[model samples]
Target: MRLRYLLLTLGIVVLGLLSRKTSICSIDFVRMYVGDVLWAMMVYFGCRLLFVSLKKSASFGVALSFSYLIEVSQLYHAPWIDSIRATTLGGLVLGFGFLWSDIACYTVGVTLGFWVDSLPGWGRK
Candidate 1:
């Protein structure tokens, strides 16, 4: 179960990165928005990977709360935080600006994550 989540997270992160580099006319919207969605799911799965004992609801709650907190943090622009957001790595981890759309993306991502997690796993050993 843990391995499955880890692999899914890795795959999503790769696709998200690729989405930024590749310009597909049909998926332009996905390229723009999917990253946010994948990021939210990555956070959820990463949390689950660490706290393997966490119940599904608790994991979802933590993921949603953490993602929301990151989104909310964008509203602040202190010099220190701003400096961090300026760097590439920092910018990726902590986004530069706030968008209401991002909240919706997070919701969608977390909901999908929950559904995936609930699936019966043939991969489980």
Candidate 2:
């Protein structure tokens, strides 16, 4: 169970890195942040691996909410967090300070993730 989650997170993180390296920011990220898409996919995969009940799809919403939480947190950047954000990985996770527009982006990404999980091969037992 734990390993599955670890791999899910790793895959999402790798996707984030690839997105950055590829400069594929065409996805209206200003209105829907980047990580939420990958995060939603991770949530789907995590629930699948754990054999979670279908009702637990709420967890994907919760994961989507988390990105907003992180963005709001940027409004008050602690020194350590700022330093961590300076790191390439941290920068991707934390982003550049706070931007209210990202809330919408996250919502879109989360919804997209939900649809992805609903695809033919996904979220199956």
Q: Pick the candidate with the highest lDDT.
A: 1
Candidate 2: C-alpha lDDT: 0.62
- Candidate 1 structure quality by residue, lDDT tens digits, 8-120: 88988887677676644357787779889989888888878888888888989999999999999999999999999999889988998999999999998988888888777
List TM-scores for all candidates, in order: 0.89, 0.63
lDDT of 1 at 14: 82
Flag regions of model 1 displaced more than 4 Å: 22-26, 122-125
Q: What lDDT does candidate 2 reach at residue 4?
A: 49
Candidate 2 TM-score, true structure as reference: 0.63
| True-structure RMSD for candidate 2 | 4.4
User: For residues 1-125, what per-residue lDDT tens digits would candidate 2 score against the true structure?
Assistant: 44744576678767755655435555555225465556545645555555455443675656666767877888876788889989977876677667655676666656666675666754432
Question: At residue 21, what lDDT does model 1 achieve?
Answer: 68
